[model samples]
Target: MKLLRVGPAGHERPALLDADGVARDIGGLLGGAEGAGGARDIDGSLLADPDALARIAAADPAGLPALDAGLRIGPPLARIGKIVCIGLNYHDHAIETGAQPPAEPVVFMKAPDTVVGPYDTVLVPRGSTKTDWEVELAVVIGRELRYAASRQEAMAAVAGYAVAHDVSEREFQTERGGQWDKGKNCETFNPLGPWLVTADEVPDPQALSLKLWVNGRLRQDGTTGDQIFPVAEVVRYLSHFMTLYPGDVINTGTPAGVALGQPEPRPYLRAGDVVELTIDGLGRQRQELKPA
Candidate 1:
C-alpha cells in the first residue's frame, strides 16, 4: 500500500493512494473519525500498528473521500525521531568524491526539522555558493531494532521506502566543517516524499532506479544497485550503535553524479534552479531553489 499525507503543511491528514492513483482519505482508520479522535498524523504509531495498517489495506477506496489533487503533499511520516544517513555508501559516489570506500558504513545525521514536503521550495542558504543535490533512497523503520542479530531481523523492522533529496552545502561541509551535519541540517534541506511505498511492495530495495534532473537537464542518474552498504546491512549495522524506533528514518546513501563530484565550476544549485527526482515505485519530488 502507498501511504501519504495530504493538506497544508503542519496540518496534513493521513491518506492512502488507491490503485486508481487517487489520494483517499483514511483519517477514520487512523484513530476514530476525522477529528473526534483521529491520529494526529501518519507517524511511527501508525507504522507500528499492524491492525491499523491492515484496516487501511482493507479500506474501500470508493467509499473514502478523494482529496483534492491540488492539495499539498507533505512528508509521508511525521514526528520522525531521527534521520540516520550513510555517506559515500555507493562505490561510484565514493570515487567521485575522491574517497576510498570504507570497510564500514559512513554515518551522519540530519535533523528532523530539515524535512519538508516533496514539492516544497528548497532554500539555498544565504552566502552559500556550493549547494548541491543528492538523490537518495530513504528507509522508514517500523519497529524498534537494537543489536539486530541478522539482516532478516533488520529487514523486518522496515515499514516502507521514499525518495529523499539530501540537499547539501559543500563549503560548510568540507572546507570549514566540524561535521557534515552543519551543511546537512539546514531548514528545508530534506524534501522527502510524495508517497511511502510499503516494504512488502518493494520486493527488492537494491533494484530500484534513481534519477535527478536540474533545470530540466538530467544531472544524476543511478541505481540502488550501486550502494556499497545495502539497506538491510545498513539497518543491521546501525542497530549495534543506536536503537531504531518505528518513526526513525535512514537515508541509505546517494549515488554518484552529485555536484560536488563534478569537475571545475560544477553545476551547483542556485536560486531559481529547479530540481526534480524520483525513485522507481516510491514516488517523485520537485523543488525550486530560493535564497533563504
Candidate 2:
C-alpha cells in the first residue's frame, strides 16, 4: 500500500494509491464517516489503530474519490513529532566522510518543522553556501516502543517507510557548530513522501536500494545492504534509551557522494538547483532549491 496525502497545506486529505494505480481519498474513513477521535492528522495516533488500517485496506478503493493529479501532494504523514536521524549508517558513507564505521548507531534529531512535502522548494538557509543533500530511507514508527526487548520487537513496531531527503548545511553542521542539529533543523530541510510504503510490503528493509541526484548529476547510488547498522538493529538499539512513538520518523542515514565527501572545489546547492531522490519500493522525491 502506498499511502499519501493530497491538497493544500493544512488542508491536505488522507489518501492511498492502491495496487491498481488508483488514488483513493480515505479522509472519510479517517475523520468523516467510518470513525473519529485521533490526532486529526496522519500521525502515530492514527496508525496506532490496526483496525483502522485494516478497514481502509478492505474498502472498495474504486468507490472512493480519485484525487486529481493537478492537486498538490503534501507530506504523507502529518503532525510528525520528531525526525530522528542515524549518522554514517552506511559503511561507504562513513568512509567517504573520513569516519570509521561506528560500533553503534550515531543519532541526532532534526526539528519537526523541517518537514515538508517531498516536491516543495528547499530553502538554503541565510548566509549559507554549503547546503547539502542526503537521501535516506525513513522508517515510520507504528507502535509505542518502550525499551523494545529485541530486534524482532523493534521490527514489529515499524508501521511504514518513506523516502526522506536529509537536507543539511555544512557550515552550520561542522563550522562554528554546537551540534549537527543546527544544520539539520533549518526550515524545509526535510522533504519526505511521495508515498509511505507500509512495512508489511517491505519484508526486508535492508534489501532496498537508494539513489540521489543534484541537477542532472548522480551523486549517490547505494543500497541498505551496505548499512553498518541495519534498520531493525538501529530501532532496537535506540529503544533502550527512548520511547518510540507513532508518527516519529527515523532517517537511517545516507550513502556516499555528498558534497562534504568531495575534494576541494566541491559543489553545494544553490538557488534553482534541483535534487531528485528515490528509494526502492518507497517512491521518488524532487526538491528545487531556494534561498532563504
Candidate 3:
C-alpha cells in the first residue's frame, strides 16, 4: 500500500493511493469518518497499531471518497519524533568527499521541524552560495527497538521506506566550524515523501537505486548497493546507542555525485533550481528552490 497524506500543510487528511492511482480518504478508518471531530493523523501510534494497518489494507478504494487532484501531498508520516542521519555511509560518496570509509556509521541529526512536503519549495539560506543536494533512502521505524542483537531484529523494526532530500549548505556544514547539523537543520531542508511504501513491498532496501537532478540535469546517480554500512547493520548499530521508536526516521546517506564532489565552480544549487529525486519502490519528490 502506498500510504500518504493529502490536502494543505497542517490540514492534511490521511489517504492511500489505490490500484488505479486515486487518492482515497482513509481518515475515517483512522479516527472517525472523514470530517469527524476525532480524526487522527498518521503518526507513531498508528504505525504501531497492527489492527489499524490491517483495517486500512482491507479497505475498499471504491467506497472511499476520492481527494481532489489538486490537493497538496504532505510528508507521509506526521509527528516524526527524530531524524537520524548517516554520513559518508556510501563508499562512492565517501570517496567523492575525499574521506575514508569509517568502520562504523557516522551519525548526525535533523530536527523534526526541518521536514516539509516533498513538492514544497526549499529555501536557499540568505548569504549562502554552497547549497547542495543529496538523494537518500529514508527508513521509518514502526517499533521500539533497543540494543538490537541482529540484522533481522533491526529489519523487523522498520515500518516503511521513503525518498529523502538531504539538502545541505557546504560552507556551513564543514567550513563554519561546527557539526554538519549546522547546515543540515535549516528550515525546509528535508523534503520527504509522496508516499511511504510499506516494508513488505520494498523487500530489499540495499538494492534500491537513488537518483537526483538539479533543474533538468542529472546530478546524483547512485545505489544503496554502494553503502558502506547497509540498512540492517546501521539500524542494529544505532539501536545500541539510542532507542529507536515508532515514527523515528533514519536517512541512510546518499550516493556519489553531489555538487560538493564536482570540480571548481561546482554546480551548487541556487534560487529557482529545481531538485527531483526518487528511490525504487518508494515514491519521488520535486521541489523548486527559493530565497529564504
Candidate 4:
C-alpha cells in the first residue's frame, strides 16, 4: 500500500493508492466521516490494521476523481512533531567526508518548518554557500514508544517509509559556531513524499538502492545496504533516550556521493539546478533549486 496526502497545502486530504493502481479517498476513513471524534484520528495502529487495509485494497477507485498529477503532495503525516536525523550513518559517506566511522550514531534535528512536498523547489538561502543534497530513507514512526524492548521490536514500531532530500548548508553546519541544526533548518530544506510505502510492502529496508541527481547529473549514488546502523537498530538506539510518537519522523541518513564529500568541495546551489532522488520501492522525488 502506498499512502499519500494530496491537494494544496493546508487543504491536503488523506488518500491511499491500492495495489491495482487505483486511488481511494481515505480522508473520511481517517476520521470526520461522522464528524469530529471518529476513530481517534487514524494513527499508526489504525494504519497497521489488517481489516482496514483490506477495505482500502477492496475499495472501488472508479469515479473517485483521478487525482490531479499537478497537485501538491505534502508530507504523509499532517502534523510532524519532530524531524530527527542521523549523521555519518553510511560507511561510504563517512569515508567520502574523510571521517572515520563513529562508535555510535550521531543524531541531529531539523526544524519541522523545513518539511515540504517531494516536488517542491529547494530554496538557496540568500548569501549562502555550501548548500548540498542528501538522499535519504525517512522512517515514519507509527507508535509512541520509549525504551523499546529490543531491536526486533523496534522494527515493528515503524509505520512506513518515504524518500527525503536532507538538504543542507555546509558552512552553517560545520563552520558556524553551533550544532548542525543551524545549517539544516532552512525553509524548504526537507522535500519529502511521492508516497509513503507501508513497512509491510518493503521486505527489507536495508537492501534497497538509493540515489540523487542535481539537474541531470548524478550526485549521490549508493544504497541503504551501506548504512552502518540499519533501520531497526536506529529505532532501538534512539528509543533508549527519547520517545518516538506517531507522525514523528526519523531521517536514517544518506549514502555516499554528496557534494560536500567532493575533493574540490563545491559550495551552495544556484537557481535552476533540479534535484532528483529515489529509494527503491519507496518512490522518487524531483525538486528544483530556486533563489530565495
What's the lDDT for all of these models?
0.92, 0.88, 0.91, 0.81
What TM-score would each prediction reach against the true structure?
0.97, 0.96, 0.97, 0.91
Put down candidate 3 lDDT per residue, 66-175, tens digits, no spaces.
99989999999898999999999999988998999998899999999999999999999998999999999999999999999999999999999999999999999999
Off by over 4 Å in 3: 32-38
lDDT digits (tens) for residues 40-97 of candidate 2: 5566777888777887878888889998888888999988878889998988989988
Off by over 4 Å in 2: 31-39
Which of candidates 2 and 4 is the stronger one according to TM-score? 2
Better of 3 and 4 by TM-score: 3
Model 4 lDDT-worst window of ten: 32-41
Q: On a 0 to 1 TM-score scale, where does candidate 2 land against the true structure?
A: 0.96
Error of 2 at 83 (Å): 1.2
Between candidates 3 and 4, the one scoring higher on lDDT is 3
Task: Compose the digit string of candidate 4's lDDT tens values, residues 12-109.
Answer: 76677755655456754543233133333334545545566566656665635556655677776666768899999999999999999999999999
Ranking by lDDT: 1, 3, 2, 4
Candidate 1 lDDT: 0.92
The per-residue C-alpha lDDT of model 2 at residue 202 equals: 97
Give the TM-score (vs. native) of candidate 1: 0.97
